[model samples]
Each structure stands twice: as structure tokens, then as C-alpha cells.
Target: MEPLGAGDPIRLGPYRILGVLGAGGMGKVYFGRDNTGRTAAVKVLLPELAHDPHLAQRFLREAHTAQAVTSGGVARVLDARIDGDDSRPWIATEFLSGPTLDDAVRAYGPFGADGVRALAASLAATLSDIHAAGLVHRDLKPPNIVLTATGPRVIDFGIARPEHGMTLTTTGQVPVTPGYGAPEQVLGQRVGPAADVFSLGAVLAYAATGRRTFDGTHVAAVQYEVVHGEPRLDDVPAELRHLISPCLAKDPAHRPTPEQIAGAFAPPQGADRIWRTGPLAKDIARRGAEAARQATLVGREPGSGPSRRRLLRASLAAGAVVAAGGGAGAWWLLREEPRTPVESGLASGAKLLPRSTAQSGKAPKPLWGPLPVAAKPVDGLVPAPLSLRDVVVFAAKDGGLAAHFTRDGKEKWRLPDVTPAAGLHPLTEQLFAAAGTSGALRVHDASTAKLQWELPDADVGRFLTMDDENLYAVTRGGQLLAVDLTMQSIRWTKPLPTYAVRGAGPRAAVAGVTLVLFGDDGAVRAFSTIRGLDMWTIEGQGKSGSAIAPAVVKRKDSNGTSYTVFLGGRTLKALKFPGGNEVWKAGPPQNGTDSWGAPLVHGDTVIATNGTTLAAYDLDGRQLPLNGRAARGPLPATPLVRQGEALWAVEADGRGVSAYSTTDGARLWTWSAESRGPWGMSGAGNRVFLVNDGKLTAMPTVG
Candidate 1:
């Protein structure tokens, strides 16, 4: 792909422009098509970084952080414009084609140990979905992967960052590649996801020894043998050099994880099913049948057939495959028989209220309706609900979200202006997303609330962390994104840790794949949501402005590991995961639990609350004793966990919903009713869901 020059631009928005698919340092790419004949690529920018507006807002934040990731192994992006006072950006994507695993290992000659264990299980599942959509492929060599016939895709994210975010270049320039970098990215230090597992073990030691496990003869002796070398795994293959010698370990905490190289090179049941075969799968199916016969002769501009935007994207992929066969995508929806509660009494306008016990006596009931559906508070707040799939939604403070029908509270579709949302996240039990302290975001249709995509301003970030296919956010300019809520797109965007002057801006959460972020100047950082990078930072931690929010847990006897609990200033800590280290801390201010906002690990106990202290601890800081006084004011807008024998909305007294006991916090039941004041609560599956001050209830789950 190369022609198109004569000063390019035969269209960039709806695509069209034809040849040229290459050029680097963030410029020119082309090879497009669109009007339904699909085939894309695009890129564009470079006119002195598109007339520099700070390098065109870092090239429109590299097309929204390479359009926030969606991996079958990468290369999807699909569309972008940029706009920050006038536009002209470009991005497009989705055209993998073939060649460039360094041109198929310089025309076939090396790969063989089951073809480098199916190319290290397809780039360890594309660096485990580009570090699980946090992104880091900070240039994973071999011309940024490519070899596709439906297999290795990866592609250039240009010098991707965001494990926690920082450096778009300038502080002592160092964007790696000195013989597949890593040794703290050639000593510039701070590169994470173990420097892309040491560039995926030097791209599987250059596909099983064609060489480059740190060779020299140039670039300052390959940056002094990549920080004092030792890599040359002499023709690797000792069972893939025991998985490429811990991904070329040089203490990026002794590498390995791309989910331990996709569980040590998985691929075997029909080895990559049909991802290219023989003569590079007949040279990638004869150049994809001459690029679909040159995209049906440049998509015949004379009488069409399949183009109403490709029949509304094939009827939205056949109505998202018949709304994904109905339900049970599971975020809770369970039931062997529940649906009996509603007892305590009172009727007419409804009132009910009482029911506590459970030190062992048991009482907990009300699984729906202590009654009343709406009469007052729709603006004072009651925003939690959002179960998704089986539909629960709610939000409403006039910003509308509504939905309902988790059995028959009826209603079903509303989705309005979406006021200040800040919740309802989900991302795929048929899609559901929200974010709006005004930076907007939107995305609905969990059964037809319609809308589908928005973005507007999109700087979003007060909190939102999804994962059934991305969503995680953090913007108001801090930027962390990920997004890809089933192609409403974005799968990547990092920038969060900036502080050359302005202060407060840290918080962030996302547990499972790590992604902390502490600050009040007591600092914290962490990061690795599958490779976004930066995996450590403790600093002063004197706890600056702590409203807490850094809980991540997973040590039920450490089989899956993960930790990072946090409280900091008055101390409480945890940390071990993806190596933030600390292990356990505790300290000053225990009883009056230092203000909080993110801690609900459970299983080895961790729970936290700041509606005026609600503690629980025990990952070694002990504490755990609450039988009576715990909930004092604002927590529970979603944090309280446990979910088996009840513990869902942890002690909320004012508009009721208490339930405690995870082995001894007691309280047990309290449902309450007379409307106007609850404002938030969540749990899902067995159910708990609240939203009061304007109705949005649901109950069940009392074990």
C-alpha cells in the first residue's frame, strides 16, 4: 500500500482516500475506502503535527488513546475527528491485511517450536488485551506486530502510556526501541507492565532466534547492551526458553505476566483455529482478494444496494444478536424462589420500616416494596439502582435513566438528559453506560432506551469502572478512559498524573487488574489494568485530602493474589498487587475511621465506609468488630459488599436498608419506607438496589 501522494487529502472524514498506508512519528497512513465497502486504516495528522495546538492536543490524544482498545488482538479504532476549536484530525482503523511480524520473519526462516508457541499464544493474547485495555504496547517491536489472517494484530499506538499517565514526551526524551528496550526502558526508568513484559520477551526473542535479544554494533552499542545485557537466549527453545526467560527479566520485578504469557503459551486446540496457515495462508488470501476487488471498484458510485449505512450496520448486528439471547449475562439476576418479602405491614400510602436482629436469630425480609414508587425526592437524590440486563437502571434526578422491569416495576425505557449521572455503568449485558458531571459520555440501549452513543465534551471522571468489555474513565482532564463499551469505541486513553502546578486531582480505582491513584500529596499511583503501565509509587503518602477510594482485593489465600486496600493518612493500607509492595499498615485514627470512599474487598474482609465511619479491616490490620453502631452519615452510594447471607446496603438508617453480619457485624434487616431521602445503594444479582428520594427500589438477597 503506497501511492496517494501529490499532497494527499482526497477525503479524511468519511474515508475514501486510497493508497499510502505507512509513514511514522505520528503522520500519514491512508489506504481507506468506506461508503460500505469498508476497508480502512486512515491515520493522518502531520502538517507540523496538524498545525500544532500543542501537537494537535497530542494528536487528538492519539485518536482518543488509540480509540480506547477493543482487541481481537488490536487494530479496530474505526472513526475519529478530534475537534478542539475547528478540526481535521483523522483516525479510522480496522484494516489489518498482512505481513510485518517483521515482514513474516524476513520471509520465513525462524519460528519453530510450534511456531514460537503460536507466537507466544498470539502475542500473549495481544498483551492481554493491551494490558487489559489500560494500554502500554509502548512500541512492541517487529514493526508493531501485524501478521493477520485473523491472528496477530497489535499495531502502533505510537508511544502509548497511561498506566497511570505522564509524559507525552519532553522530559529527557526516551520513547524506547534500543534493541527492544526494557531495563527500565533503557534506564529512563518508570516503564511498566514490566516494560511490556520486556517487549514480550524481545518479541519472542525475535521469533525464535533470527536474533535481537540485545545485539549491538550501533545505537550506542544498543544503549549499552540494554542496560548491561545478558539476553541472547542462544537460539531460545528450551521449551521456549522457559517462557522466554521470564520475559527477559531484568527485574521489572522479574517479568512474566501478560497473564503469565497467556498461561505459558496456550494455543493448541486446533492451534489458532484458522489464523493463517501454509505459505502465509496463501499470502493472506491473495491479498484479501485484491482488496475486495479494489473495494467493489471503489464502491460503485452508481446505484447502490447495501448502504443505508450498511443497512444500519446490519440492523445493529441483528439487534445485537437478538438482544444477546435475552438475559443472565449476570451481574446478579439469580433466583430459586425469592419474591416473598414485603411483610412488615402498613398499606395505603405505605410505611413499614422495622426488622433488625440476626446475631443468629434471623429476620431479614422485604425484597421489593416496603412499597411507594414515586412522590417526592427525584432531585434530592436516589441515584444508585442500575442492575442492567434484567433491567433496573433508575438514575433520575430529572437527568433521566429509568428502565425498570426487574420483574415488573414495569416502566422500561427513559434515558433522558442524563443529568449528573455518575453511575449506571455496566457496559454490556446489552450495553449500559453513563457519566455526566457534564462532560457527558452517555451510551444506552440496554433494551432500547435508544441513544447509543454521545461523548460530548467527554472529559468525564468522577468515577466509573466497568469490565465486561471496558469503560473505566477518569477525565475532567486527568484522562484515563479505556471505553469500548461494545464499540461506542475508545478502548484506551491514559493521562492522569499531571501536577506541574495546579493541585488536587488523583483518586481513581479499578481493582482486578490494578489501577490505583491516591494523592493528597501522600501519593500512591499503582497501575497495570492489563498494561496501561506504571505499577508502583508510594511517595510521601501523608494522605492529602483523603476521601479514600483505593480498594482492590483478592487474597483468599493468595491463589490469584492482588491487594492494594488503602486509607493512608491516618493509615490503613494493603498494597501487594502487581507490586505496589507495602503488604499491611494500620495506624493512627482507627475507631473514627479516617474519611473514606472506596474499599469493599470481602472474603478476607476489608469493607469501609465514610457515611461517618463503618470499618472492618483484617488483611492484617485487624479491627473487624461492629455488632451495633457503624453507619453515621454518607457512605453506601455503593461499596457495601458480602452478598450471601445479606450485607448489601451496609447500615443506612435514615430511609432504611441496614443488613449486616459477614460473620458478626449483626444488624441483619431494616428495609424502611415512607419515601424521600435514601439517594443510592447497589448490589445486583440476589438484589438490594435502592434510589429513594424519588423511588427506584428492589430487595431480595437475604441469603
Candidate 2:
């Protein structure tokens, strides 16, 4: 929670506001408590918007609608002041002390089948109660459901209305969330309790698989999919799919009622224990304790033994509320920073590259320089550069890992003992993982290069990938080792498949609970992050001599959001995540040879090379057209990198780099160097960093 800012009220009604829990464009939700020691989430309308009749009525209606539902599955309204002109309009509800469903799923990974069933039953019962109150909850998405000590408790009645009312909206705004909303609601037609049932199905799908049932690239496309497309349940477990499918029926009349859904799901006896035990329960208990402490310190004076401000600072320092997730509009007990891929311990995906203003067909000038900071190639291989938030890291020519400012080629800091070959991975935006001498795992601050933590017994050989909880690496003996970050101890170790350890070390990526490793000898393997058990494997994807490094991209298509691994070999293949099942495959161009290199994914397109030609394909593996002049190149076996509209790779001659327009694969510009060495490329913050021989250069991206 943030400290109260200027112009903020100290109290509302009988409650004393302690800190700001969360805020939206319309108002703010304050962490509040009364003299009786009861805590509440007090939502008050913005003073400026209080005079706006439309917003004021909506705010008041939320209070009335929320108060009407008297179920233990919902947050009870403690007090409300909506009728008086002299008072500021506010509604205070019991503060829920737990993460929202969205936050929980994103932080802890998707729930197991039994856990999802428990969630389904709890939410269904809540929806049944809301419908019984002669009202319809128009917004029943993940963020509205909080996983408390008891079970899931539905919160937020901001858009609820009478069951007979038509969907309401101002101007062109849609009344419901895009992917989770029912078709009738998307059409702005009359919605019944069935709308909430449809939303429940979407929520359950996400809870089961950590993916939405319907998704698209933009808001309009998602709404259109909700209206006209079928719900994607391929990723949802087979046994549970049958129960969730019926609730997402396109027609309202075909969807099951909340009571029927509750009966159908019928969680096992003691299923509620899923939320009452394990790490999730521990997190909920921690938050609850923090909330109680905040309540006790609320009315303390400035010079008291321990001030509320100091307690809040202590809470933040203790990582009490680390990250918030879900829709931006959802408010919770305590707001925190949002989790990024680095923070969540997930594989980083393509960021939205900044739009360049340079002419589309013109060659852009260098943004920084061709600085001589890159290390010379070791056995014909240059370490791939890594891009952090503000600095680009490389293996310095003087022998060590060095960080250079992205804005300019100035050196920020260097670690002479760090081994770039051991594989450098970002643990968070501010911290990174690398190996010190003798294969010891070390964590360093990104900006200061200070050693924050180290594990001397890790016996690290090659750093692979990491997630929120553990850092995965391959030991010198070719065994996969998982080190738990929270416990600072080894979690598990498993022997690598014989094929995976025969040649160069494998490249790895983490998606959800699965960690995928692609070996140099064309061996692909998937392991469960929870236990280091083998999940699946595929052999002979490429020739024995070739190196393979597959790229994973999260794409939303007719099959919903798929964490697909794009593997390039004789064929460019898209494999479903976790299972390594081939979704689609495309062979090389009609007359081209069968050899292919590693692939790169940007947005919806996957780009790769076949030694003689560069090709682009959609996530579905359908080959896309490229301009004739730029499509053909004697590209080497290297991974492609993208920045803005340009896709950069080694040019035909292998001594320079060429940038192609991502849209049509037309040649945009080219940069050549005199050095006769391999090229490495990486991009971040709208600038592309290139390493040729031992020279590093940063080039500006053009439209």
C-alpha cells in the first residue's frame, strides 16, 4: 500500500484510512479500520467525479448490489455512506487477506486438477448466491475472486445490476471484459445469470491451465472471438474439460446454471483443504498477519513506538506484497509492483519494441557505437549477448563479463571472474545469475555488479533457466540440478538423457511448470519444474552434427494461448508446450535444402534460415511470403534477433549483418565489418546490439 498523498482524506465515515490499497481512474480503495479493530477496504469515488451523475449512480449502485448478497463466499459490506449530501460517498467491505486468483495462478503456477475443481465449486456457489439476490454480476473475472483462508471469496460489484436489466455502457465502451464476457454481454444485449456462468468457465479454464479460453492480439479481436468463435479447451485437462465446456456455450440458454455447475464439479470431500494448506495457505496467512498489524497501527500517533508508516516499509522490505497481477482495474487489500518475466521466473518473451520514426526504406545510423568491448571468439563461438533493463551484457575482450549502458557504449561494471559461457540469466530486473570460477553459482546486482548471494556447493557447469522459485542448471557431470531460491538449497537432481549430454550443452527455456531443453544433437526434453521428473522427449529432430536451440513463444490462436516451442531443423515445427507434441510442421522452401537453423519468434511470426534462404512463418507453421530480393540469403546457422520493425541476422557473406522488415521480409538496411569472425545479436529498448569479432556496435532500428 502507498502512503496517502496530497489532497487525500484522513477518514471516511467511521473508518480511519491508513494507506492507499489501489486506485483506478474513477477513485481509490483505501486500507481502512474502525475503532472496533475491524478492517475494511474502503472505496471512495474521486471528489471531481462525485458530481458526475453517471459515475456517482454507478458507485452507489455497487454498494446496494454488494450489500444484497449475504453469502460467506462474498465479502460482506461492513458500512456504506451513499445517501447523504454532506458525506463523501464510500462503501467499506471486509478486507480480504489473500492474493487474487489471477495473482495466485501467475505466482504459483496453475492449480492441480483437484485444486481447480475446488475453485470451481467455490466460485459456482458464490455465483449461485449472487443470482439468488435478484442481481447479475456483470464482471466475474479472476481478479474479482480472492483466495482466502476459508476458500475463494468473490469481491467487486462495481458493474452488477438487476437480472432483468440490459447491459449498460457509456458511449462505445463494452460492458464486460473481453475474453471472459459472455457473447450476449459482448453484444450489449440483455444478460442473465448465465453470463456469470460463461465467465466462470473462462475463469476455471485459466485456473486449470493458466490460459484464457478465448484470446486475441487486441481488444476488438478478443471480443469478436468471444462472440463468434469457439472456446479453446485443448490445454484444459481432459477430465475437467467436459465440466467446463458446457458453461461456455455460445448461447445463454445452453449454458448451465450456477447450481448445476456446482453439482457437476462436486469437488472431493476435504477439497477445501487445498486452500488451507501448502505454500498458498502460507502466503494467505502472511498477508492476513500483515493486515492485522496494519490495522493495529492505523490510529497511532507520529511519535508512537512503531508508526504505521514504518510498519508499511517493513512489510515491503520483507516482500510481504511483492507483485500484483490481473486486470488493471481490479483493486485488492495491498497494491504492489507487477511481476515481470524476470521476477516471475518465466522465460522472457518479445517486448513491444519502440516505433522508429526513420524512413521505412532507409538505413538508420548507429545509435551508439561499434565499441571494442566484446570478447574474441572462443573456439569459433562468441557468447550471445544478453539485454537487461538499462544495460547490455557481453563477454568483454579483456576476459570477463561486462555490462554496457544501452543508451551509450560506456562500461557500467565488469566482473573479471564471471564466466559468460556458464550462461548468464536475469533473475530479476535488478539481479542476474552467473557462474564464478570453479562453477559456483553467484547472483549479482545488475547496476553495481556487487555480489548479493552465492552458492559454493551448487557445482554449476552451465546456467540454464530460472523461474520465480528455482534456478535450473546443468552440473559438470551432465545432471540437471534445480536450486530453490527461497530456501537456498538444492531441490532435486536428475540425470540427463544420454543424447542430451553427448555434445554441447542444451539451451533451455521455462514456460509455466515445464522446463524445455533443446540439445545440440537435436534432442528435445521436457522436465517438470516442481520435481525435476522427465515429462517428455523427442530424438533426432535434426542431423547429429548440427546445434539446436529451440525458441518458445506464447501465441493466442484458434486453439487459445499456446506456449509453443518453435524448433528449426529439416522442418520448422511448432510443438505444444509440456508434452512436446507437434502442433504443426512446415518443410523447407520448395527447392531449398532440408537444413535449418534455430528460429526466432516476434509477435505472431517465427523467422529462421535454411543456409540459403531466410523464411518467415506464422505460429500455425504456415509459410509467409517475403520480398524476393531479401528472402534469399546464404544465412549462417544463427538465431535471429528483432528490434522494432527490423529483424537482424548475419548477412549472406557471414561477415556482416542485414536488417529485414518484419512485416514483409523486405531488406531495410545492412551493416558490414572488416573483421572476419562470427556475429552475435541481441536487442532491447529499441536498440539492436551487434557483436562482430571483438567489436560491439549498437544500431538504431528503423520503421
Residue 95 in model 1: lDDT: 64
- The pairs that clash in candidate 2 are 345-467, 345-468
Query: What is the TM-score of each predicted model, taking all chains together?
Result: 0.29, 0.51
- State the displacement of the C-alpha of residue 674, model 1, in Å, after optimal TM-score superposition: 18
Candidate 1 per-residue C-alpha lDDT over 279-348 given as tens digits, one digit per residue, 9 for 90 to 100: 5666556556555655554455545542322222222322221121111011001111112212111011
Model 2: ten consecutive residues of lowest lDDT: 339-348
Q: Give the TM-score comparing model 2 with the true structure, all chains together.
A: 0.51
lDDT minimum window of 10 residues, candidate 1: 326-335
